[model samples]
Target: MVKEYYDPEVKYMLWDDFQIRHIDDLKLKVKGYSDDECKEFDTTEDILQFYPNFKDFIEQFFAEEELVNSSTRLNYLSNYADTKTYSVVATEQLTGRLHVNENLFKPSPKVMEVLHNATYEDVYLYDLTREDELAVEISKREEISTDHILIHSGSSDVIKTVMSLVLNKGDTVLISAPSWNYYKSIVELKMAKAEYYDVVPGKNSYEFDVSGLMSKARAVSPRIIIITTPHNPTGAVISASDLETIIKENPSSLVIVDEAYLGFSEQKFDVRHLLAAYSNVVFSRTFSKLYGLAGIRVGYGLCAPMAKQVFRLDVNPFRVNNISRKMAVAALRDEKYYKGLLKDITESRNFFINEMNSISGVKAFDSAANFVFIHFSENTDVQALKDYLAQNGYLVRLWTEGSRLAMRVTLDRKETMEKVVALMKEFLEK
Candidate 1:
């Protein structure tokens, strides 16, 4: 090689030889060959002669890489990796437990029947009419036109699609402090900026700082504003009058109202008036919370005609499959069952709040939604209490902001709520 490494007529042959030798070494390593055995291989063909199965592995590996990396977006996006060992252990310990913090419960028997009776065509076919069918059902329920409704896989998908369509680099999105985390992630993904408005602690529960939000909106003139009614963790709701005021003031900005938890609230307001009044408003809802179909991922939005036209361009025609559509429709039709469930949830929520407030060091806030937010005093052993709850087949969401500690427990069956409250009482007595 030192004497004739760069012959002009044999240059191509030399390059080919080098590549084959390197590939043979890689194959040997992949086959768990020792360095001594690898030294015996001079070419890919020679390695294949020793281990025939090695060729299939190398070919499949390269094919998978070629397929995955073919997308241009992958070059800039971060690659996902498995969780660390300790994180995995913690997750395993909490698996299959009562996840009260999710605000989830079993679906109606009618909805379960539809799922169980799914036909072969329902699963195998393309379901071209599923989205339109669901839209019609939603339109009838929401009192909006089918043309103004757009069905999506979930409310999160609605957010992602709308953000992708509207946001540009450096655009501003106004969000409330301690809003849904998905909003923050989606804003960052679109390379946009997020501006915050505070939700302060009121006399009863957390509430939106309307004047503060309006003041900021006037200053930033954000491209989009997200308002989550019966907002998560705190269960604060924005009044319809206040909502209209915000929309009227921010005439140019697109306003998104997230009503995912609205079904559980005692005070119900029709959003059709706002939708008819403003072309810049969109109300997004999901079948996850009250309907108990979170796993199926069915969500829809009521948009103004102008907004609907823009959204349809990017939304997939077949994004929601046949089975999901059927289940959502079934859930919507069985309103009586849901109403009964809501009554139970409301009762359980009131009981939990009243009981938790009776505890000396704990303060449970009034919630319009199906979950209660309980704040622990500074001296209380919050971590020990959480561990005690976890040990007794219950898992809740713990919220920490600076030195403040709170637990957000979803309203479960009356019996389960009674048991959890008793456990908390036992823990605090020590």
Candidate 2:
């Protein structure tokens, strides 16, 4: 190993102190055993990695040694999400003037101006706004009134925030499977039990498991019923009628719809209209997906009583920056641009499904968003293809031990994805 010369007075810092982002750290290095023979262990065997644990090694490499759930994370790009690389991200201009990448952040240009005009803002400072004020505005989501919209650390906040609206600790949350993974995890994180109803996979991709979903929500009377519209992984959009039936049956439970993928939705269902019909219903929206502001992180919730309670809590403020807010507002304002993007991505998704379905060993599902989920031949290690794609400058999400060869393909409208599909078929043929 080569050693670098350093000043004697310079102090050494621990990796954890700098707060390196997880993805960046992964780029610098990777984790694995040099010896493949002992790569895996039995129950007592698998836990033996604890001696030279895989998770620990991964965290250490990423300088997140204390982070939990290291090995369990699948590369999100390859999952249900449209990992369409951010094409419109902010670029530094020679004039030093800034232009927002509408694909990646929220709160649009207008929102940015509003935030900048306000006294309470400092992008570099990671500032906070008054909870009661900002959260209070979130309350005016529908005809009903609510004041709560507390910001939390992750998508899990959807649950914690909504629970504050409708659930007490230890409340039951009914969830439908083949939805976003974080939805399941968030409910459990909030000191609540989760009831899952598996949807029947149909001719198309992750179909809404309507009958099962309704049956279970009725039985549990869960305090919160979470549904994903234009769902992740499955790429299925829940019908308005099914949504109506859900609210009609679960009178006791609050219905929380997670519209994380709605920007990519073909038909925009105005669920907000339902808030007029049911006091027990709310919708959660995030800028992460359609606006492509996954990193900037501005999520909005629409509710009546639920939002009212969210504003009163002592949560962090200005969690979404002027930049993110600016971009989001841009996304909302540019329906033409957003619509054009939707058309391209929808076409890509359809093309992917048709092409992949033609392959003998592959099964592709109908998707409404910018990704296509494919089940590969039996024992197909989708990781092999993912690794190949990554090597080809493409990043994908991978699923382990699923019903099919599970991998998520992002929409770039570039030739790369087409070639990727072709290569995958070639690999299958081999």
Candidate 3:
């Protein structure tokens, strides 16, 4: 009798009694599985029954295949929309695309005032002083010296510059699975080998599998390790103590912490002590999320003096424009405005998680950031629900893992959250 098995690692579907042992030359190497080695399924539905997480993606794959092979393809060809074009159309109609969590709130009025009052020097002349001025403001805020702060166009530029500076061909880089994903891409771009540690789902939120990370770090002795706090998509954070433990364990490796969502998280920890103790740590922060200064594209990194010196060699002295630097400085000084925004975000996030959890067959995880991660039970028609939400002018980020169909929804205004919850219930009832 023939049986089917799915490889979650490489997302391959295997037929017959063979299991994939490895890959070579773009082909899977298979060996017959022992009775105890693999789970067997007679049909795709049976596979779904046993592995709930694969249900959504597997079903969608099959559906798409059927659509392509059937008469529907020919009939629709004249007016067909490819996935990319369809996405563009859908995005154009969205009330707001919550997938990215771009701040709907405006930046501090001071930022606008500075931009409005900008002179020709701010636009045409070389940025000589503003970057230094912004660094001084950040140094005061972070309680770090100006020499240790590296200002860039955005945190992403920092990551890229660091990778370019540090990564040699075939150097091993360790990062968490289900992380920013861009980390993996950049590592590969540098011709470096990327190794992943796990980030497992927990009762209330996703958590770092720290022990697993340490194990991988020991085995690979990776040159760089990247950690994200108030982690993207999952909204989980690594405690400062745990972070220190990781840093202490791998003394030789450069540990980079992406704290782009810093102000949104409720958990507070100081990195000043860590910076004082370790020279191998880099903490990246951005004005994009909390300050609503994404349009300005200003970000900075706190690094040790030694690391800063090496990074400076590759960084442009005038990377940030004069206008952007001044605007970022303005955002920094308006603490009261940001505090009020943080309060509203916290309330909206709480309301969203609570309401989502109240729905049958749905689980909304607690988050430390401006978004919530939601999981739908196997029985839920997630694709249908996603379509319904999109039709109603809402858009969210969606993906699937073993036995789970999940989405990350950005917290918007309270009224928008209420409408979303109501629409979800309306879809479920139908």
Clashing pairs counted in every model: 0, 37, 5
Q: In order, what lDDT does every prediction score?
A: 0.77, 0.58, 0.79
TM-score of each: 0.77, 0.67, 0.78
Better of 1 and 2 by lDDT: 1
Candidate 1 residue-wise lDDT, 268-314, digit = tens: 65678887778888888888888988889889888877777888788
CA RMSD for every model? 16.6, 10.5, 13.9
Model 1 pairs whose backbones collide: none
Cα lDDT of model 2 by residue, 1-430, tens digit: 9778874323443222122223354454433233233232323324543465666654566566324545665665334232222122222222211112123222234445545565544345654544433344444433334342433333445555656545556788887765555555555445567888765457776777778877777677788888877766666787888888888788888887777677676556655578657777766777666755566677766655555455436345435554555455555665666666666666766777788888887788777766677777665556556544544444556543233336766565635458767777766675
Q: Which stretches of candidate 1 lie over 4 Å from their true place?
A: 1-104
The per-residue C-alpha lDDT of model 3 at residue 212 equals 96
TM-score, predicted candidate 3 vs. hidden true structure: 0.78
Clashes of 1: 0
Q: Which pairs clash in the backbone of model 3?
A: 52-403, 53-402, 53-403, 53-404, 54-403
The TM-score leader among the candidates is: 3
For residues 209-297, what per-residue lDDT tens digits would candidate 3 score against the true structure? Answer: 99999999999999999998888878899988899999988998999999888898667567788889988889888889989898788
Candidate 1 structure, TM-score to reference: 0.77
